[model samples]
Target: MRVGKASDTDVEQVGTMREGKLDQKHLLFGEDDSPNNYDLNMGLTGGGGWRTPRHRHNFDQIRYVIQGELPYTETEVLKEGWVGYFPESVHYGPQERAEGLRTMVLQCGGASGQGYLSVARREAVNAELNKVGEFKKGLYHYTDANGVAQTKDGSEAIFEHATGGALRFAAPRYTDVIAMDPDAYDWHKSQDTGVEEKWLGRFTERDLRIGFLRLDAGAVYQAGQFNSIEILFQTKGRVTAGGTEYGPETGYEFLANEGPVQVEAVEPTEFLRMVLHTF
Candidate 1:
């Protein structure tokens, strides 16, 4: 089991085509070679807003809006407390935001068999690409080995070169975006004392699970041994686990067989729980 405080994590600034000047705090990063390997991060888009070109990833991604808003489609916007899921190779975006957009993002290998790449790793590749090409207006301009000027979609070019043309994979489990509002779900009391839960939805094709937990003040909750990777993001009030107190924006990750965990609510608290089963 691993717990982290948002205030304690370093904020990293990465400059790139898709990211712009956004700030990110990495909460968890899974092992590189494992299909279940994943990355969870909180991203903050500052005053000037953020924009990204239309593109697709080899992996799947889920974004939960924590604050502000971003447009998923010309007519659809993701506001606070909303969630959006993007499956592998499903193109969407030309993403844009006006100001103060904050989101928690989870990325993992898609059921399509394509691998996952960390933001850090992707940044490294971007840096290398910069030396040989230039990213401008959401496109990459380069002179290939044949010395011919070429142009390609920025994200497509980067992933292709980074994976050495091995980026293709089986079709994704879901081809369209999935969006939801957790607040719209009904809460169900847990068998555990003082704990109530709301199941958001499950993407069985990707072994993904999502839900919310609400714990009353001074209540204790016991977590059973998990058979998958579990991530908890504090959404309201305060909770203590493993001798550390966590408030909103803080998150924790527990691996399979990590055993039962004891969680205590220092105050009335609520959190979003996401799990990726190994099956």
Candidate 2:
């Protein structure tokens, strides 16, 4: 098992930080197949300051709040530990005020050799119903071993049938992002599970496989026939991946180019895992 750690200074690309106003910590940027298009950044804003004017983009956007509160025009105001998903070809502009605004932003898909916003347009008073509709649809669902829908409302929250987490780099098109509560599970120490095991769920979409994983202390786990790149984010405790040892609040990534590697839990651990398979 290997792991990697991303430091505060390691992320310095400020996509839109105003002087003495706001700052962005890009955790994972320029990864996977969609190099020019993919971006995951954290934003922090100062008090008594205004955020960048509302704008639109050709690509999709997802914002997860790690702390504090921020408001969106169409969606409701989000506080700490909330996630907001914006679909491709939609408009999302925020007018927020806070002691400081902090958020994690993820972007996927590319078009016409353009980066981020294709054109710089003026900020507008967004229409109540911003866009006609969104390009993509809902999250993928699964039927449990009992043949009943594991997720009653949707797959965004807990999914009993989910085996392993899915990744956008693996199944770019079918990948749908979700915001979840970290304290949703009753986590136990690794020694509890006799054998080290992880279940990456079935493909929600043909090319997409997403789920969660838990490992016992010193338990080694691996996958066969992965045929796609996988991304894992440390959600609970600590673990090692890709020749690195990472603890909580760290992200580790691996390409299936070689073969499946050992994934072991140093302590008890959980991860937000996603594998994107080529069709």
Candidate 3:
């Protein structure tokens, strides 16, 4: 799995057309920009000549504008920190812009659909962190509504903005290990474990899926089978995702596609586990 911030790696120039003006840097996938796999492409558009003729793809895109506003036909403009999910291809992009555009896009494999963000509809929803309790030795929040309070160790739940943000809760000082198990079909309550657990909650309408995880000192979620793809974010602590181990600064990611794997917390690990649906 790849770890580290999306900007850490130099963008690879896969192909460029029209003299480096409107070229597509192959972000995630291989060189071809072909089909059948997850591909993330970063688009650097030169001011004035940036355009992606109305088209569509066969996957979903989670686009994050890193620099200049990317002009799109859907709403005309998408600013930084602006995330838009477009299913497959719904006829969008490069409407018109005065300056250039740069974006970090996350595309899912075998995905189809068109989704967009209404640039005109930007609202601030007040999100709060319910710090139910303190950590045993560090900064882990140990208060779970589902589990019994005051047990050896408890779990904490913090809510982040529906769209995008860093994290609502910080990792407690003693949170040394991390465990993530995403339930796709069934829901499980947090159990009383001596270790601290941090639950990253992402709310949706359809189904409720949680990255039910926990972390303890010197503990590694030694490669094992998880319910869903384990997307690990190393906020603080030495950890490994898949076969790749990263440090505190490296934002490595690993995907456990319905199998067993190991995620070891080498240091005082503190990260966020995004539970797809909760509430």
Candidate 4:
């Protein structure tokens, strides 16, 4: 198990096809050189009128709004504390926010086995592509070897050309976006002592699991071994694990078969946990 605090992560500016000056703090990343690798990032938009072009990624993404509001559809908005899931190849936005926004985002491979590219890597590729092609209206435009003009989805082109042959074509896990308000859900007590959980959603095909856990002060929780990738993000109070104390915004990743992880609540604590099973 690996534990870390959000304040300990380095913050960097990562430009995207979006319209804002965005900075991000990386919380966790999957194993190196693995197609099944994933990334977790905390993003903060600086400008008041930030926006992103209508775009899609090669992998699936889950985002939780920590602050501010963002438009999800023509008639819908993702307010603070809401969560959203964007499946691979599913188009959704022209997302925008009138004020600054802060969110936690998770990007991982889809059920079809398509790989995910890190935002930093994608930014580097976009820089190179910018010299040869122009990204406009969410599409990349350039002349082919035959001098014929061509246009492609900005995200698709970036994935194909930037990482060479690392990515493969695959069917998206879902065709539409999923959003939820945790406050509207009920928390159920788990078998674990002093621990209560609220299951958000699970995608069996992708082996994706999302949920929240609440623990009483001085409670001890044991995370049993599993053939999967498990991640915990502290949202309220404090929790100590593996000799490290973590507060809100902190996160931890537990490896597969990593024996029971002991987590102690220094106070009444609440956190979000996500798992991606291998089976």
Candidate 5:
């Protein structure tokens, strides 16, 4: 088990690999050797906001809007307090986010098991690619040996460069992005006293899940019951575990069948929880 406080994580400015100016706080990172390697991060859009072209990836992503709104496309927008599941191989976006938007995102390998490419590796390759080509407006512009100019998606370019092959996406399980409204789902009483749950959805054959958990003040809950990795991000209230106190924005990770960990609510608390894809 690992616990991460948002304040302890360093902030980084996004690179030119994408056409945007955003600050990112990477909170928790999984093992690089595993296909299920993942990164959980909080991103903030500054003054002019950020932009990403219409694109897709081989990995899955779950996004929750914490503040302001996210414009995923020119027409489709996710208002604050919304959750979206972006599955592998499904295209979305030409995003034009508004300033002061805050969002938390979890990026991981999907059911296809292609795995996730680390941001560190991507940035390193981007730097090398910059010497040979230029990234412009979410695309890479470069010249070929035949003396011809060509353009490729910047993300695809970096993946190919890093892996020494073309990036191939699996057949999409969902035709479009799945947008969810947590408020629309009613919380159900859990078997544990003083605990309630709202499970939004479960996806793919790998059984990736998205849900929320609530604990009343003074309630004690046993966590880490899932067959896969379980991650919890405090959305509100305070809790204590193993004599340590945790507040909002703090993250916790429990590995598969890692056994139970007791969490006692010092005050009424709510958490956004996810069970990563089973490998």
Candidate 6:
């Protein structure tokens, strides 16, 4: 089991691949050797906020709004406390996020086996690309081999630059992005006493899952006993595990069936749980 706290993580400005300003607190990073390596982070839109063109990725993402709403499209909005699932190769935004909007995001490899890119690698390429071209707004402006002026999506440009090849996207499996409201779902009792769950749904053959877990004060719950990587993010209250006390904003990780670790709730605690995609 791996545990980390948001307070221990430093807040950093977002990469220049996207438009505007945002700051993030990265909570957890998955095994780098694995194809499904991922990053879990929480970010807040700064002064001018942020925007993204109508774009898609080769990876999957799960986003939860903590404060303010997410303008997913020109017409659709995900209000505070809502969640969204962005499937690989699926397009959604042309978004214009308002200032002070805070969101928790998980980005990982999708079912298509196209491994996600690491931030470290991407940022390295960003610096290299900076010497050749300029990133303005959400686009990269450059002069290609033919000496012709070109403009491309900043993220796509970074990927191609890093790999020295054209960026490719998988054939989309899901027709559209999924938006969910957790409050509309009812919490059901889990097998463990004093523990309950509100499962949103599972996705793809990989069995990726999104859910909420609640543990009443003084209760001990066994966590991380799953066939795939399981992550639990403490959203409210406090808990103690392996003799360590963890408060809100703490994140825990367990490898496939690596645990049934004991976690005791010091206060009535709630957690956002994710079962990552299995290869």
RMSD of 5: 1.0
Residue 135 alpha-carbon offset, candidate 1, angstroms:
1.6
How many backbone clashes can be found in candidate 1?
Answer: 0
TM-score of 5: 0.97
Task: After superposing candidate 2 on the true structure, give the runs of residues whose Cα lies further than 4 Å from its correct spot.
Answer: 1-4, 11-20, 31-37, 110-211, 221-227, 256-258, 275-279
* Cα lDDT tens digits for candidate 5, 3-49: 88888888898888777689999889888757788989999998887
* Alpha-carbon shift of residue 141 in model 2 (angstroms): 45
Best by lDDT: 5
Q: Weakest 10 consecutive residues, lDDT, candidate 5?
A: 28-37
Residue-wise C-alpha lDDT for candidate 3, range 157-230, written one tens digit per residue: 11122235422222121211111222222333333222355442332232222233445555655322333333
Model 6 over residues 1-279: C-alpha lDDT tens digits? 888798999998977778899999988887654668888889899998899998888889999898999988888988998889999999988899999998888898888887778887888998888899998878999999999999999989998887788989988989888999999999999988999999998999889999999999998889878898898888998999999999988888888988788999999999989998888
Q: How many backbone clashes does candidate 2 have?
A: 27
- TM-score order of candidates, top first: 5, 6, 1, 4, 2, 3
lDDT of 2 by residue, 159-184 (tens): 11121232111213322333344345
Provide the overall lDDT of each model, using Cα atoms, as 2-decimal numbers: 0.79, 0.45, 0.39, 0.78, 0.91, 0.89
lDDT of 1 by residue, 1-279 (tens): 777667889998755655456888988888786777788889888767777777777787888998888677666787788888787778777788766788899888776555687667678888999998898767889998899999888777777877787557566566667888887999988888899999778885656777888999998877645677788888889888889778888878888867578889999998888887455
- On TM-score, the stronger of 1 and 6 is 6
Q: Which whole-number lDDT from 0 to 100 does residue 241 have in model 4?
A: 84
Two-way lDDT contest, 1 vs 3, winner: 1
Model 2 CA lDDT for position 140:
26
